[model samples]
Target chain A: MESGNLRCGRRLITSETGRGEVVKIEGRISFLGEVNPKEGKLYDGRSIKGKVLIAEGAKGSTVGAYVIYALKYYGNQPLAIIFEEETDPIVVSGCVMAGITHGDMFGKLDLRDGDVVDVWEEDGKLCLGISKTPP
Target chain B: MHLTREEERMLKGEYGEAMRIAMEIVVKVGEVLGADKLVDISHAHASGVSYGTIGEPGLHWLRELSSKGAKARVYSTVNPIGMDLDDPNKIPVGEQFYKKQMEVLQAFKDMGFEISVTCTPYYLRKPKPFERLSWGESSAVAFANSVLGSFTNREGGPLAVASAITGKTYHAGLQVLENRRTTHLIVHPELDDPVEWSALGYLVGEKVGSGIPRYPKPPQDEESMKLMLAASAASGGIALSVLEKVTPRGTYDIGDEERVEIDEKEIEELFRFNDPELIFHGCPHSNLNELKKINEIIKDKVSREFWIATSPKVFDEALREGIIQSLENKGIKVVKGTCSVVTPIERLGYKRIMTTSAKTYFYLNRKGLEVALVRVRDLWRVVT
Candidate 1:
């Protein structure tokens, strides 16, 4: 019903889009990466080793279902996803599956890949103001 | 909002307390989506009971809101749950998890639900393609709306069940045949093989999130539908593409239609060149026939170490038939429950995975899934 003068970026960590509130933030070793709206890949094809990251929703989980647990255990994926929606099923499902702490009310970043994002909390609401981003 | 005489009675609580409660929840959903009136859908589908997210106060809140175990009189269906609780299978999960889940599912079954645990219920139990049926599988929702021409609103996990039980839904966007119309103009198949189908679906879905799409004709097969539907769910939330002549209703079943254009780049990312970690199949959960074909294609693969994924039900069936066990003896993992994109492969400390399945290809890359990549059907050649 209400939106501000926003420069919408194609990433999950910014508030200019559907799940703009930076609810939770994670660091390197993030798995079950949120399905990024920008990158379009469910995996986003990024090197999260030490990069400040962003993501959409969660992926998949369940202990013994047998699709990819062994692969992740050996792969060493350590990155975090930004909560764009209430509970992005992809990121949540992935975190649950990977046994990682997927955050929702934790970090701040007005992301657009290379954008110098201005994210903050206003009262109880989260807001993002982007100053720059990658083309 | 004019209510039918029966609807008015239910609103006044003249109907049994249970029906009244169910209607209340339906009404809320209707209001949220800005529906004018409620309509009757003959069939429905739901997410079913499983470990809900750590986010929501668990699914118990949803359970409490509606009659969880209430019998769904409508010809209803459901998605797969979190692994079997009481199974004595070879790779059975913990008994506690099993017992706990069985209790949850039993409540629903007690309420008059059937326990078929597949995603594309339309396949296992054929619904006349275009007939309006309520379903919750995101993949199935789009598939139903677009491909099958069956009517649905992409109803969420619990709401889908509520709609089934009460025999009525809030009648939002799914109620009328007008807003239910497709806007996407033409979808040209960019990928000739199944591998490209994943990215193609992702591309289309991302462009038309929560929007309607009309396409040339879906791949006239189940595997193709699965690949496209999975990416559709991944790219956005849900999309009900107007499946042209193939749609259940088509000209005979469709209303007036319009067209919207899509970006080619959107469809390409799914096959975006990335190191592979694993090959995935059965986005809507592979059914038996599909698995049988996949098993046949992989029987003599030289890859001592690789991962193949499907539902536990299929895996168990494959195991009982000695298909998977033989492959396991050959060091292949025909596993279930976990997807390559979400598995904590780094935790187990292995590196790299290779898989085919556009759904997996897109998802794994986002979470930084490690490894190599291969086309899904190529692995099928192994058993072939």
Candidate 2:
């Protein structure tokens, strides 16, 4: 299990934050091409529905922002998003518009796929708790 | 971040619900990008109009905004849709899909957006030097910054829409003068054709990614420059490139920039391709001259399908000048307001395609289509 202070540009869009299993993708994702918003399934056959989707950042089309919106519209959005590198405007704008909670990994924590993670905001600071056991 | 009195009023919802929503999005994105304040913008262009790309959720989102009485405060233009709005039956899309596409289009129109439907807005109205703009569509951002001497970040569709409504964007990224400085100087081997220029841009974009590159010599022709900028934006997310003498003076500083040179052998690798089932042009929407050049190339009818995509304005001009008829007489299909990159070519049963635009090749390859890069001059010979 691993834990770290949450890092992001601004405050979380949603107030309610909870725990979920982490689904880590190694590369940058183009939501338009690499994701199916209707099903919330990635091109690799893994599901992002109700999980903390971790990735390097977004790539490809600017239409990617709307894909994230579609994910929420279909009730298949991720529990949260955790990215490493600079968050492109497409992802950031999409998360804001959809009212999804997202933060940055900040290269401080080593996370693995299937790791159970909990996130919350405290004293104007975002905190994360990681555990091996399923929440 | 500091906000003006009027900006605060808008954020506080003194300005309608649409303005409040737009202000929230702008300020949120501004904070994320570390923008200190908002800057006024003269124009905004919104992308993500294609039904094939955005699907039902995007359609609903636009309709929702229209219902909320969202209207553009500044002059705004829209990107290409999934099919031609004027003549939808000409495209092979289903009637239901066309209706959905029209719904999205109508919503944008209701929001006071001009139906330009072009990736290259510079073709319609060129921006002056150092003019602030809020533009989506990656290729247009690159072109506007590098070619038209405008200041704009590579905006997302939602951000551009927000800017259209609010008439402002965050003062960050390429909108800041210090951020637009050339960091790398790339010396390239001489290129004669538009395809070669596009290939060079594609290679450089992949090498530099988001970094600005300074080219010793830029393509002189409008088509080649357009292709170069489009390819770079497609391949590497490059928002701007500084051309030696072409880019306006005092706009970018290239002092002591790290220099690199690209040889001819490297560019030769990009031109290798197999025979193509279809030929496509206008990833960034063809200019009138490109349409004329294509019309001259296909003098006689050929066997394979040749498609030329252009904006509605260009298409109308071409139609009036008999360029469309000449191409159509040669069995070429000229489409308006959409291109192969944004549309789903699978519906047309086209698995393999060849194009001169590296931007088109890069995008279609990601969409699981077989794309071959070929020179525009060599297209007729190879395809036939």
Candidate 3:
């Protein structure tokens, strides 16, 4: 994780996260609003071609999984998902159970939009800790 | 926070052979979330009944564990049972819809739960708020926790029942109220109608993400509280986030002036919808007046098959009044316990779904279904 690799109390195969220049996501840790952007017209107008979404579980939509699954199946899934609160256990459970690793968002990782994030996986673990890019 | 001897035995597999594995899974889930002791859950509502296209092994493991006589030693509620149809009237339009309903129900009955088909079990049999209840309806959970002020976590499928039987839930999120203190979302709004409030909620769910939104005040009454809770639940799949001012512990920070702020510009943009085949409601089950309002609103405009799901109790009331039949005569199907979301889209005979509720809209969008959205009261207006 460009930010920091925090997975299950640091007990997984090491070097399992991605290494890249930092991307700081400047967004509120909302226990409201929603996570799945595809469900609303709120999706980016131009292209979310490389932007990584940092959210817990999506709000209001059972299709959260469907949208994520579709995006992943088509290679448009978020860079990673960080959860401050337990949104839907299924979100992480499904991702993990399916081997689709979205790096963990844990322990007060404040993210804002346009924060360049780098992600990857190793030994059944994914990481995406964030840091502010160079001003 | 102490465990009973019976619970301890269940943990160690003394009850049923399956309890050993099931209880262990519960214990592990709790341990991961740092729950202290087991809490008795009177009834539970569950989800894993639908065979997932996501995890086959997890599905298989659940099926096998359930097959081994894994009854939840406590009363439980589950998702709507799918019925097997012989004909569109024999069951409904398609066999697949009915079959899925049947399979889901059969799985529950096989596991020892007396199946009741209604989304609002509270209406059928209201579990007193704060009574330990294990439920899974996203909107229902919020209603239970925030509206009714109950004690429950979103029993994560059947395993949640295992935790309930053993009386142990991972004390991570919803179970712990203090962890529910407001995160203070500064809502900057400009409207206060139901439709506006609904859209504001959608925006809040989007902007707030996963932290509980703390307002400066609470909704004025049950009606306003209802809207706020609906929006909060919709944005947070788990539902039941504390409304800063109205909730028992959350209101202190939110004085009399605390409330939800609406971004009319954002809401105007968000409320836009394309042509929709159907307008659906009752994902969390509508209260009496809401149902009546629906009945009155669609008295004229409900030209297609409309669905408004509720508990059997509500369904019965409608049946007695002939409201259900009246709607049926008008192309609306007022069913019990089943909502349009869970029914196969094909079964509903519509490729596009539309709604005012952010929660419903999100699901439709997620499924790649064409959805036209309007706010709640607006939906009533649109239907009429």
Q: lDDT for each of the candidates?
A: 0.52, 0.84, 0.53
Please say which candidate is ahead in lDDT: 1 or 2.
Answer: 2
lDDT of 2 by residue, B1-384 (tens): 899999999999998888888888898888778899999999999988888877888888788778888999999999998887688876778888888888888999999999999898888899998999999989999988998889999888889998999999999898889888887788898899999999899988888888899988899987898899889888898999998678898777765677767789988877766667888888889889998887777667867878889999998899899899888887888889988877767778888888889998887887788887788888678655
Q: In model 3 chain B, where is the ten-residue run with the lowest total lDDT? A: B82-91
Residue B296 local lDDT, model 1: 63
TM-score of candidate 2 against the unseen true structure = 0.91
Task: For candidate 2, list the clashing residue pairs, or say none.
Answer: none
Q: State the lDDT at B179 in candidate 3.
A: 57
- Could you tell me the lDDT of residue B126 within candidate 1? 62
Candidate 3 per-residue lDDT, tens place, B151-191, comes to 66655554554553444455556666565455545565545
Clashes of each: 87, 0, 48
RMSD of each: 11.5, 2.8, 9.0
Q: How many residue pairs of model 2 clash at the backbone?
A: 0
Deviation of model 1 at A6, angstroms: 28
What TM-score number comes out for model 1?
0.63
